[model samples]
Target chain A: MIDAARERIIDCDWHYQDSFKEVAAYMPEPWRTKYKHSNWDDAGVKQNLSSFFPTSTGDRQNYGKVVREHSNYPDEPEEPERVREGMDFLDIDVSLQISHLILAMGGVNADDKRVQAFTKGYVEYMLEEVLDPDDGVYGLAPMPYSDVEASLDILDRIEDEEAYVGACFVTAGASPPLGSRKYDPIYERCEDLDLPVVYHTGGSGLDEYVRAGYQEMIETHTLGFLESNMSQIVSVACQGIPEKYPDLDIVFMESGVTYIPGLISRLDEEYLKRPEEAPLLDTRPSEYITDFYFGTQPLEISARNELLELCFDMIGTDRLLYASDYPHWDFDSPSIINDLPMLDDDDRRAILAGNAEGVFGL
Target chain B: MSDGLVEVGPATEFEDGDHAIVEVGRAEVGVVRADGEFYALRNQCPHDGGPVCKGIVQRELLGEFTGTGERVEQYYGEECIISCPWHGWSFELETGTHIGDERIQLPMYDVVVEDGIVYVDTGE
Candidate 1:
């Protein structure tokens, strides 16, 4: 049904659950022993999902009704074989399997050698467990931005592999955001490999602003992404990352598309007054945004037409890529844009597949 | 027959590029004249109940190009575009079709001119 209607459906945002146990298997001698006994949630560990109010969105009418289906545990991730069945059912041409917690906590929080251990383990396991078995599946190599050199080594190995589309640089549970000078080597390596650097953030990593102690999971889930993507995108513009690496194509995921234009507007206002702050930016901060792509899930369909207009006027037709957060409770359907009256044939085609092809160089 | 027709009086009432509300039964239809043609669409904008008939009439913006080291704004054909003042969603006066989205066509009434009088089929 999905394939017949659209030219090519490239799902930009999808998830894979790689447990610590899975990565530990690939760890070398001494680290393997430490991984077996280590607690992921130890105090000051700065790991696992950071949250305060679990029931944050207690104000919504359907707040209590947020129930996730499970075959085993409540959030039991479907095995790769079962996921293959689901993908075939959807007929999704490209599913970019993004990791949420694996690199965000495991590699970023781990020390130097452990960073190598976690990242390399992630690539090996994802290749064997997720992408290799299915033609429809594509992988995003999760590199620990904490250790740029090690990440470069891993990117060299997997970047040429046909199954791997790009690399993910998650902001959660990390230092200095995505576009920091520390991560420049990693960005340069990704650019050299001709792969897009995907900024996929999750969990409440910024605990300072979050009402942590008493807030519910709902709070972290709902309010967590407030500064998640904007802060990182600003980092890119303010630090002149786009000017630094014009060839680099960045894809910001899990954030809605409408706010980008508005964010750019605010950033441009600052740029006008503080032009000296970012001498590398040749145009408005938002103009630099046009060089990037965005994933659309959790799309607010209440006023879908206006949303599309905002995208067209600010982001352009090719900037918004269709994303289905598959297997998650709130996964957007592939046909989410099918009924959008604002979208012409060209707009629909680009969002569905063409845009992704350009970014991922598919 | 006067059945669904609203007597908009003489065609002279609406000159080229002019628009007015014609009340047929209880429904109000917006009557616009452009390029020697008359268009009748529901006065209310389907999107936000704004006065669609009273919106600004303009040409369709096809695109722009400045690659040759200079700015050039371009347009093709005369699509009598009326933009909703509230949200700025433009609609084509002739077909009552939205400029961007094809699915959200506005309610259009059939307009006929007999002799010199303008009659709108409000179809109430």
Candidate 2:
């Protein structure tokens, strides 16, 4: 039941660092044995085999340093109590936990079997330890992109559970993208289950930017989220995901507001010039994008309020879901919205919590 | 020229590619002289809260394609664009609209020069 007693402040993208050793206990059979035997902490194994995206060692450190200059957000909390304390500090009533380690699933260089093990283990760990709906904490079941049957089964397992509010679709390093026919079965199930698909972008995932020889986290972090989401949005539009599963709630997280205007404008321009190429699209691509939701973490705020006001007009106030992404390098405080010069009381309430309640069906 | 017009300075104070940020009523207005013409835009950028008028005023870049996605030619165009010092998001000086998206614009004011002194109609 929706809590009517207080003004809602739902943080749609909260996170904590994953405990790999603990997660291994939840893994199935031989993979569990393999993970235990492997030198999990070795820098090489962590970067190459375990992590989905391979970031430069020095640049990765620099990335953290650079982002920390923006805000004084607390470090990642390892325990649930600490997580709640951080949330309390931010005045966030509900936090949907997006796993930091599990986000690497998109670029994991391992085979399907191992990938399935990681996915299963991660969700189980999240459910068993992290999620506490009574306390307003929830998690998205990480869908194993390598196996359709397994992904559907995981959704089935979480269908009756109140804690699993959505299914995670990690976009980094994902081949064939989310719009491909192979992934349709998962989307169809998510629609049937009333689960939103949260497209979470990451930095340490095996992605095109990393492959292109970006040696600095500054370069990779900047382009990685923006470019990957752009490709996925384009792919989803051309493939007609909106038409295929109209009920599916699509949410793109992490990428800020500036990317939206340029991307949608370009997509609309291209669609107008070559309608034949994307016959599945009924109207302009920008229209389809506007229908989707966005998580406003690391919201780009500048001195000029009118620029952001124009962005809000373009995306519409209702479509934006406030996400703190707390305990990260550049987390946004609720005051970011509260302090916005253009947003009146209604706009502030909608972005801070109202839209998230509707989108997540909380 | 009227009670509302805030006197900036002598018209001769501004030269091509030069600008002056002046207080008009409660708002800050930038009176710029670009390409031998005078224009007034809000001191703030619409993209981010950058001091847009405080940045460079120069020619806009133009590009062309030749053959079937093969060769390309790039050069500067006749239009003047003011770039935000923060992120380099440029806007057309003539219209005060973002070059990439015309929907975004700096709040503009009318500039009047009479009897040697320049004035910005802040509409206060």
Candidate 3:
């Protein structure tokens, strides 16, 4: 019944993991010993997926069991079949699949050749295996954050590759804001190449959280997504990336949309009060913000109707893109729109597919 | 409920880049144009109560990923700004929510264009 609409459904946020053996293959000798000794294997990946679904009542009680059990060995093997199954179930037309461990690419030492090797391996695997045969599947290439030059080089090499859509950057890492002079070359390259940058929610690696005495897996997991993206948005805006590049397209993946309207408003106000701080910007912060795109999933329907409407009013319909954080615990698909009582047919259609077409060039 | 939808104005009355503030019951709503499409949102700012309908409606740049696969650039769209003529807090006209306060959001209304006339749902 939704075939026509389904064909238009482009999932802006999806994930892919590496196989245990594949990861083990690239680990340096010292890390390989640690990896093998930890008994890091594919079973852990299956366990993660199973825990995400919690099919049975007993499974629900064991919600955090998988994360706890694999705390020391959190890596997972990529299961391409499981991903395909998810796409089939959701009836998605296209999925923007991000790297699994790629989130850690940010923290990897730039001087380290091993980081580059691993990134190459991951990108190659994704292009050759996951995306090549499936027209509906697209890869968001991972860059080596340890070395910005190396990252740009990798992007250049794969820029023309089939099924390669854009690049993914972890929200929290040692890398400066997208606008910082340190990242100018990268932003310029993306601006020149026209690839959109993706800032995903996870991949903080928990170093700070662990230091803060936070041990609960759920707390770490939930807070990681929220803090990472929120800070990234603020950093990008404050650093004046929008003004510096003026053309850099960025997407905040899996970060809910409810907070965007408020964040942009605040940024604009602060910009006005302290123009010297963001001297490069010629317009209000929100004006530059509309230039960027956001993928909405796990919509916070709990927000008041006026609030949701207000967000749409501020953000504009074209700037908002639709997404299904497929296979995740809080996966939200097309049906979620049906639950929105205030949205009319046009609003619902725009959120469902129309906006996505404009964003992804569908 | 009002038996008939409130007639805001003639569709042609609102220029491509303009907006109209219509009174429905006790509430004022805003209708604006962008990319040849019309959108409506509540007239009140979500941050501090302010008249958003009178806010400036302008074209602002939005970022886009070009086909080149490396460069990202900006594109413009119609945006409504309700600046608190007092505090100068600007809200995006399409969404009634404040710029940075995710906690507060504005109400949005529905508008329709027919035979060159603009009509708004008064919740009637």
Candidate 4:
């Protein structure tokens, strides 16, 4: 079923809904017992805390009303066969299916041991039940950054697993930011293994939403991702993580590309005035920002071609990877990129798969 | 019934909230039935070229600010709308005007039911 007419497509951020109860079965003894017995009655917490906390405004899609009312997409926790069907529909050759629960790992307000245990459980479950790279269904190892040792161990375990092509850093509510020297060991390991690191962000900025009095999904959804990723860009670039690691393949997923121009300009503006504060950086912040790859899922199709091209030009077209956050309310079809007037065949091929092929070494 | 009219099907083919996409000359029109009337619109979405006719047909959701400046929302049952499946852009079924913006409208075709046959004046 491969479309010979086009280049191979690799979706970097295909999200898969993993059941908490199922992941719990993979958990080691005491945590498994605790997860099943815990009584968190608030519906929002109960519904999502098993994976990650829900957004302050609650579920973003109104609980799949769009799918029920308008779309023909399958429901969550789809079998691998169904996922293959989805990839086939989009003509995607490879999909790095991220677990929804593990995506919330960074945002979870829990003990490091509990987080590590659940992270291990989730990864193990994925390794056993979900991953099948031969079918182009690959996965990422969710790094529990709160404990560097544990994160390193998870990386070691997945280093040899063919299904695991990258390591994920859930960017919501990540303390000390990703640029902190505390995470150097994990970065070192990833660099050593030549595994790309994906910084996938979530909209569940619970504390930020509540503190900012964001009453609606629109408000929080709009700023939460931008705010989180922007902070990380500043943290990573200023703290010199890019310079220190040198070879760590870094990717910022979920957020669209438009934010890059503004954030980098702002970083450069501030960096020029306060070079003393961030002594580790050897070049302009924009140069490092351009080095990082970005996932184009929620690829802003609404923007006029010239504007989107401008953003791509700033980052160089090769750094952009096509990601379809499918089954979500705002999923982009491959046609969105395929039909864009601005992209010549070369631009389309690069964004669709070429960049990802190089980045993940597929 | 008329020479210029494009034959869609029998009038009975579409029930309330039902739709059928038909090729009319060079145009693809989605003929929908709502409240015992037929409305025809170009199947393609102006927003993103999505198949707008294949989307959900429902009452439009409306919002208003109350006297205290608090926002309240309700579904206005008087108007039936079709939302684009790709991005959920809603357009009025009868007029084909975007519910949120009058400037963006789906191309509409005139439908006439004659002697039990539904015909669309696709203006070929």
Q: Score the docking of each candidate (DockQ).
A: 0.01, 0.03, 0.01, 0.35
Find the number of clashing residue pairs for candidate 1. 12
The global Cα lDDT (0 to 1) of model 4 is: 0.78
Better of 1 and 4 by lDDT: 4
TM-score of model 2's chain A: 0.89
Worst 10 residues of 1 chain A by lDDT: A65-74
Q: Tens-digit lDDT track for model 2 on A23-52? A: 777889887887777666232212343446
Q: What is the DockQ of the complex in model 4? A: 0.35
Task: Give the poorly placed runs of model 2, Cα more than 4 Å off.
Answer: A1-6, A41-77, A205-211, B1-124
Models, CA RMSD each:
16.9, 11.8, 19.3, 3.6
* Tens digits of lDDT, candidate 3, A75-133: 44555666667666666667878766665555555454756666766676676667742
Q: Write the per-residue lDDT of candidate 1 for residues A204-301, one digit (tens) a residue.
A: 44333344553334555555564677788898878888888889888888766777777888899999999898888887888888778888876656
Output the better candidate (2/4) by lDDT. Answer: 4
Off by over 4 Å in 1: A1-6, A37-74, A103-115, A206-219, B1-124
Give the lDDT of residue B18 in candidate 4: 85
After superposition, candidate 3 runs with Cα above 4 Å error: A1-7, A23-76, A106-111, A207-211, A215-222, B1-124
TM-score of 4: 0.89
Task: Give the distance in Å from residue A330's predicted Cα in candidate 2 to where it truly belongs.
Answer: 1.4
iRMS (Å) per candidate: 15.7, 8.5, 20.5, 3.2
Residue-level lDDT for B117 in candidate 3: 76
